[model samples]
Target: METKVAIVTGGNRGIGFEIVKGLCQKFDGVVYLTARNEERGQQAVKKLEELGLKPLFHILDVTCEKSIEDLAKHISTHHSGIDVLVNNAGILDFDKAISSYEDAKKLIDTNFTSLLTISRILYPLLTNTARIINISSDWGLLSNIRKQVWLDRLVKDDLTVEQILEFVNEFLNAAKMGKSAFFSIAGKYGDYKVSKVAMSALTFVQQRQFREEGKDISINCVHPGFVMTDMTKGMGDFTPERGAKAPLYLALEAPQSLKGSFIWHDCHHVNWDD
Candidate 1:
């Protein structure tokens, strides 16, 4: 078997942490347990070592182009192309409303744009038939929309990535004007949902692009079931380990054919439009 190389962003804590731990045990490869903070990343690595797991710490700030480029350079020099890339770093804010422009923009930059930026930077370093597991959520699915069934209509039938981005831009514009009918009707934060929808859409877009380019890479998005972690303040019912299961499964264990899927942990297919 080939020696695989994997990178897990935000691997110092929460589901990201557990995914790194799980990967160390489940996959035979060099696992880069990445964190933006050098201290935190190394501490996590130390703790993992104490637990008999070996993982390397890489300083990665997914939001920063320089950080990502540096990582690409390091990987290019030290190893072959990456075998798995888990775009797991994310941020959340339930404060105020979409009209809080700064807060909303923070969400966009963290939850959506940073991952996209990281993906773009690392794309050149992915090996043939590599796996890209994007952590998403049920909220991204159009079926979660309370009404406006037509919105679901737009995402039906393996909707192309370009179409998904168009809708995402529309929703962002709606949130900017405080006219997000989805928020009003769904009674939730529209910006966050729109961002995840965009994230999930990006996974599909990349998957298809790889297919069209005849590349063997497989990019898939996954929704780890809600789990208790710092992100949830222990409110979630499951543990971080539980949430980590899905992303790790998709990234390290699932069959290749299941790649490029937007799915939930129970192996249920995600209907982004539904």
Candidate 2:
């Protein structure tokens, strides 16, 4: 039998770190804790090792194609294929120092576009029955899209990845133009919300495509809850460990039937259209 392998991005700290720890304890496979900074990534791995948990370190800047491809090549050479992937790298820049458009562009690029790029690039390396867990947010809920037309498009059972991309691009263009209307469409935390919403929609589209192609892969997006992390400015109700629970469940133990769903931190399936 081939050795099982799991990859967790942004694993240097917070929820990503906890997910790595959990997988190290429970997953009967090699768990890679990837981060953009080599030093921090190695440090995190060493810390886990001190706790008597084994986790490998790799440098992965999700926004960089070369970085992603290099990691993909490494995985292909070292393992038969990937068994689980957790897309946990993201940013939340509410800093008033930057312009709103700049912030929006950065958020979309890191949180949404990078995900699409990495998934497309590494998709061929996924083994049958592989699990993909995208770390989304409560803001990803379809209800956050106040515009009925946008909601209708996203909720379509036959929604395509192209459509999701178009939706994201439209928001980007609007943000570029400083369109307050588009910002209102997603309400507070507009850029972050739209990016996550796109992620959740993409999850459904990917799962549907997998089914149509007769692949055994499972994909789901999750809201890790408002965890107290640097991204949240340390003002959330849950801790990073609690935030990792749902994502860990989906990656290692959730039923395949749970594919394409948006899940809460408690592991309950959330109605994406609701």
TM-score to true structure, per model: 0.89, 0.96
On the 0 to 100 scale, the lDDT of residue 35 in model 2 is 98
Residue 113 shift from truth in candidate 2, angstroms: 0.7
Q: What TM-score does model 2 achieve against the real structure?
A: 0.96
RMSD of 2: 1.5
Report the C-alpha lDDT of model 2 over 1-274, residue by residue, as the tens digit. Answer: 8889999999999999999999999999999999999999999999999999999888999999999999999999999999999999999865532237777888889999998888789988999899999999998998988777889999898888889988888777777776575565676677888899999998998898999999999999999998998877888899999999999999878987777888999999879887
- Per-residue alpha-carbon lDDT of model 1 for 219-271, expressed as tens digits? 88888887777766677767888888788878877888885678887766765
List candidate 1 segments past 4 Å from native. Answer: 94-99, 145-163, 179-186
User: Which residue pairs clash within candidate 2?
Assistant: none
Return the top candidate by TM-score: 2
Q: Name the regions of candidate 2 deviating beyond 4 angstroms.
A: 95-99
